[model samples]
Target: MTTQNLLVELFVEELPPKALKKLGEAFAGALADQLRAQGLASEDSLVTAYASPRRLAAHVSHVWLKAADKAVQQKLMPVSVGLNTEGQATPALLKKLAALGADVSDPAAAVAALKRAPDGKAEALFYDSLVTGATLDTGLQKALDEAIRLLPIPKLMSYQLESDCELPGWSSVHFVRPAHGLVALHGSTVVPLKALGLTAGRSTQGHRFEAAVSPVVIEHADHYAETLARDGAVIAGFEARRAEIVSQLAEAAARLGGGVRAIEDEALLDEVTALVERPNVLVCEFEPQFLEVPQECLILTMKANQKYFPLLDAQGRLTHRFLVVSNIRPEDASAVVGGNERVVRPRLADAKFFFDQDRKKTLASRVEGLSRVVYHNKLGSQGERVERVRAIARAIAQPLGGEALAQAADTAAQLAKSDLLTDMVGEFPELQGIMGGYYARHDGLSEDIAFAIEDHYRPRFAGDALPRSAAGVVVALADKLETLVGMFGIGNLPSGDKDPFALRRHALGVIRMLIEKDLPLELDGLLAGAWPVFGERVVDAHTALADFIYDRLAGALREQGYSAQEVDAVLALRPQRLGQVARLLAAVRAFAALPESPALAAANKRIANILRKAGEVDPHVNPQLLQEPAEQNLYQAMQRFVPEANAQFEAGDYTASLQTLAALRGAVDAFFDDVMVNAEQLDLRLNRQGLLKSLHEAMNRVADLSRLAA
Candidate 1:
């Protein structure tokens, strides 16, 4: 068998910039996977993916010209059914052999060739044959077809291909884009195949305008990338082009020499990389007076609208100059720079206009406008949602920080959604909470209130920061709680991977604040407080919503490196104060490490089963009813250790509490080994059950020890 490196490329119209990276990876991965599955490529084959604005390609090394032949054995039928008692093949056996393309000309010879093997209780006849392997041409065709079928194309386009015949007609073809050419080479030979109405060739177009050659010619499979770069004026690999863009951006920023750097956003970088073939970083600038608007507005406009990188100074203030990644490298470059600067001026001016007009009316004035803005069809207007949040925030703050904090929280919550009516926020919804803070400050509100209004939407996504002030924390909690409860109450719970309202994120935010802030409020109490705010708009879904929050918490804890068993044990108790969950998990981990942990856990499981079966056994045990020596010893051990464990638990030293309880493992094991929990006498059985129940309660103060049982 001969092996050679292979290269394949698809030349098409511009691809969607956001999906280019994943498209390239999926294309190459599926191609190589299909080849390996067909045995035309080995496991150690190196696969390199190339993607540009107009092309997707892959180079795979160590691909076989023809896979090696394999010996295969297949079951035919049971021996009793395939052969007669005369040791001759039956008509059914001959027919099966004929269908398998076996030598059926001589029935006796065919019968002799069959092997008998035991399959379960019966012996079966097996056929042995040599299966010919796939050739590169056929294998590559299948791989190409599969790769294209498996592409994660965001959307498909339908176009017509001109007919090759004399008849004037066209054929419709559907693909991500109107593909014009395909290059497939095994070593130096072009693999004969056709896809998307184009025959495989050794040449492809590159860098729509700047290519040194009209059509870049790939001389060999190994030379695809090098030849493309030298003749086509394009960087074929996605990561290579992205890295070049990064390096050029850094160099251009260094030339400014004020400790200035481009704002770091990976998504923007990737999208920009996908939009260009040969990246040439150019310095562009806008009027410095545009700086009057918030830097966030300028940054968002540049990155989101113009795809430009806004430079920031040492103090993290936006500079007048920005960097642009141009596809063409012109010598003078002044025209490119001027054109980009001119294009961004109107966008900046619009943001400034919206900012100026928005400040004329204070956030308090805009509060009335939110009544007209619909939040949810079932939940009424934003005005109604604002009142609910205010109520919840006040309830949360009253217990956490007394009356002053409650007043601050109420004020912040009242103005929080008011910005949704502002022109600036209306134009850029991402800046809803952000614009509120600016307008609040402009209205002569205190910094505390302004910051709270802004930070109320904190932790909008995973890894995002929480609120900075106590008032902000209250408002954020209230806002997320209102969403969770209201949505869950309306039976809009997240199903499968669908969470249109981001209910899962809201639940996680609530959990993070409760635990990370270590707020003294109970989880159930917070949910209860939020329910009444909705009044009759929502049904009683409190239990379901709490379960949802706890589930999110358990997942989060597991992601933070806690084992499933540890999370299960701690969460099993439904600890209302989520702040203590981390400590409970830590205690469980510590308890699980004890040498006596297994026996105690097993005994705890046994005791749980007994108590459950006993049905409502009291924890109180009359000392006189303790007849067994083991039972009396266990009671004495509990008297010494249970109080100490209870004291440690009360002090929030969960690890110490669990460790203290570990001291009774010996007595617990002895009691389970010697005494019967369900005795013949009713009094004795109830007393034994009561003793076990008391032990169960003490052991489970930190976490359910039974869950730790292996």
Candidate 2:
């Protein structure tokens, strides 16, 4: 067998910039996987993917010209069914051999060649055959077809190509983009194949306008990337081009020498990389007066609308100058720079105008407008939702900080959704809460209230920060709770991956605030408080929403490196105060490490089963009914250790509480080993069950130790 590097390329119109990275990876991975599955490539083969705005290509090393032959063993029918007792081949056996392309001319010889093996209770005859290897041409064709079929195209396009035959007609072809050329090479030889109405060739177009040659010609499979780069003026590899863009951006920023750097956004970087072939970083600037608006507005417009990276000072303030990644490198770059600057001025002016006009009416005045904005058909308008949040926030703050905190929370909640009616926020929905804060300050509201109004939507996504002030925390919790309770009440629960309302995110947000903020709030109590705000619009879904929150908490804990067993042990108790869950988990982990843990866990599990079967056994054990020595000793041990564990638990030392309870492992194990929990006498049985019941409660105060049982 001979091996050589292989290369394949598809030249087409521009692909979707956002999907190009994933599309390139999927194509190369699928192609290499198919080759290996067909035995045309080994496990040690190196696969390199190349993607640009107009092309997708792959280079694979150590691909075989023809796979090696393999021996295959196939099970035939049972010996009794294939052959008769007369030691002669039946018609069925001969027909099976013929279908397998075996030598059926000599039936006796064919029967002798079959091997008998025991399959279960019966013996079956097996046939052995040598499977021929697949040639590179056929293997590559199959691989190419599979790769194209497996592309994760966001959408497909249909186009027509002129008929190549004598008939004057056109044929419709569907693909991600219109395919213009296809190239497949093995070493220096072109591999013949056809895909998307295009034949394999050695030439592919490169950068649209800057290519040194008309169509870059790849002479060998190993020289594809180098040839394309040198003659086509394009960087073929996606990661390589992205890295070049990053380096150029840094070098250009360093030249300004003001401790200025480009805003870091990986998604913007990747999208920009996909849109260009040869990246040429250029410095562009808008008027400094545009900075009068919020830096967020300017940055969002530049990155989201213009695909530019706005420079920021060391203190994270936006500067007037920005960087643009142009696809072409012109000798006189002044035109490109000036053109981008001119294009961005209008966008900035629009944002400024919206911001300026939005401040004319205070947030209080806009509160009336939210009544016309629909939030959910079943949940009424944003105005109605605002009242629900205010009620919930007041209930939450009354217990945490008394009347002052309640007043602040109420004020913030009232104005929170008011910004949804503002022109600035109406134009950019991402800035709803932020614009509310700015306008609140302009309305002469206190910093605490303004911050709360802005920070009420904290932790909008995973790893996002929580509210800064106490009032902000209260308002954030209330807002998320109202949404969860209302949605779950109305039966709009998330199913599978279709979370249109992002209910899961809202649940996690509530859990994060409750636990991370260490608010002295109980989960059930919060749900109860939120339930009445919706009145009759929603049904009783308190239980369902609480379960949803706990499920999200368990998943988050596991993601933070807690094992499934550990999470299950602690969450099994449904601890209402989520702030204590982390401590409970720590205690469970500490208890699990004890030398006596396994035996105690097993004993605890046994006791649970015994008590469950006993049905409502009281925890009161009569000292006189303790006949067995083991039972009496266990009772005495509980008297000494149970109080100490209870005291530690009351003091919030969960780890100490669990460890103190671990002292009774010896007595617990002895009792389970020596005494019968269900005795023949009714009084004796109940007394023993009571003792075990008492022990169960003490052991599980922190976490259910039985879950730690192997």
Candidate 3:
């Protein structure tokens, strides 16, 4: 048991944050695969990888000093495609394998040697059988080199433009950015590998601004991280980057009075990481005049245009002051502060002018303008959509109680896109929905109406929130439903993975809102009623696109802590009420853990098997054809249970209905046990099948129990 480790580092100019993160992960995976492929990674040692904007590194411990034994399996697809039962290569297999350069001759051909992987006998067969063998079993160093070569970098380019070559200068290797150098060490052992256009060395570069390209030598594999940090670069991984941002923002904001609060800017943080090797806090203030603009305008101008953070007062009011994270310490910081402030003034001024001008027109006045702003060619004008929304929202809202949420919803839906007519919102398209909400409130519309306008687009993404207010929920559902109906009407149904219109998101949005509010509206009928509104534009639901909405629900239920099977069970009952489906899923999980389901499943299976065998026949049984007492008793039990089960199902008590069916399981088991279902007499068999068919019919009214996998 000897000990050894290999460390490799790549130093490059800053790469884009997303590309860096992706490449980091991909490189790490590729490195592990390379190690295992070469037997350098085993149960005995570990292989790990890490990446940041400036560097990517991988470490393998107990790495074999010598290359491991290798046996390459090349394809012989054509030759093996129609191979015989005996160990012989088809002429095609021989031809293909020969073209593939496989040594198929002498003792045995490649296809001839291909055998059904013997059970537990050979590891190679299992590895080789994978789709495309999608695994590497080559030399460790070679595999690492190959993986780097194959890594996908967005916007890849050659650095050098000349030498009569259109081919760009690769990092002298394939990478999104230049690979300045490589550091390769083996537990302080230098594993020379420069031939791959990479150096085997113990040294690495420091911060691009302060430390420049100065290389610091590392003595050991574990010290690689610590040494980089000590060199004033927070390369301890992404956590270092995140921690720096939080602390710097807090410290920078504290000097002004309140701590800096993070804006809704996941994308900005990523870009910042790529732009800096070291992070330090910097705060600057602007003229108070900018604060008069909409907070979104103020915030967006800084984050999107200047990459700055707009400050907030203790009361959560936007202040003119802002923060910026910098890569270098400023001697006279005012230079940096003044530079950013100067750039933001023009952008903020444009926002203010738009806001002032937009307030001149009332939301009602802009209603006619929405007709020109087409929602979807199939969905009709936004004005027409507002009408449908008004109708749908009114029907859905009045029932939510004390909230007057419905009126608020109708008001909001009418004003939802009215901001599009505004000059400011036109320039800042991202502010479309938010500006509408702001304008409604500014124009003295109720808070509920304003909030509904804003929150209608809530939970826009998978994990996003659903509207909590009744009015918001109604409008959100109405807005989504109209879009769905209009899309379906015009033959724009999404097929396979293509959903250019985001109909899937709209469907999920409606379902999530209805479920959240416990609205008891029937979705199928709601969709059908909107037919007149959609007219010839109604798209058919023949594709899986309709069920795809349910798939979204199933996913949402899982996020709420229900297992996929439990969700499936609830949906199997065809429960249209999402809230009930949620409760039903909980019940199914509880019942599944009980001692009764297997017995019930078995009994349910018997009923299904009988019905399946009977195949599309009438459920009616001749009373005279039942020769056995058990058959009569089972039939009697099911007949008695049907009324209760039907009521439970109608009330969405799926579990209770399932329980009602379960109660008949004992009678069902007895009937099948005590009687020969395939009776010798033809009429008797029909009678028995009819009895089972009736049992199935009772169970299915509650759920499509036949679809339930045992």
Q: Indicate the TM-score of model 2.
A: 0.98
Give the alpha carbon lDDT tens digit for every residue of 161-248 in model 1: 9876688899898899999999999999999988998999998987888899978999899998888889999999999999999999
lDDT of candidate 2 over 23-82, digit per residue (tens): 999999999999999899999999999999999999999998898888989998999988
lDDT of 3: 0.70
Worst 10 residues of 1 by lDDT: 162-171
RMSD of 1: 1.2
Q: Candidate 1: lDDT of 79?
A: 93
Residue 690 shift from truth in candidate 2, angstroms: 0.7
Question: Least accurate stretch of 10 residues (summed lDDT) in model 3?
Answer: 123-132
Error of model 3, residue 90, in angstroms: 18
lDDT by residue (1-710, candidate 3, tens digit) is: 35567677777777777677667767766766776665666665665666777888777677665544555543333322435557466666566556555576742545445644433433212112322222222354576686677677778755642222466553333457766677777677776655235556788877766663466778897787788777635554655675678777877677666554645476787777655667776777788876777798778767877787777877777887778877776678778777777877888888888888888888778988988887766567788878887877776666665346666777788888788888877888878778888888788988878888888777688878887666777788877877776676676777899988788888878787768767777666566655565555565652344466677787777888876666665676556666666666655665566666677666776677766766775788888777688988887887788888889877867678777767776777788679998788888888787777777777765445433446
Q: What is the TM-score of each candidate against the true structure?
A: 0.98, 0.98, 0.80
Candidate numbers, best lDDT first, in rank order: 2, 1, 3
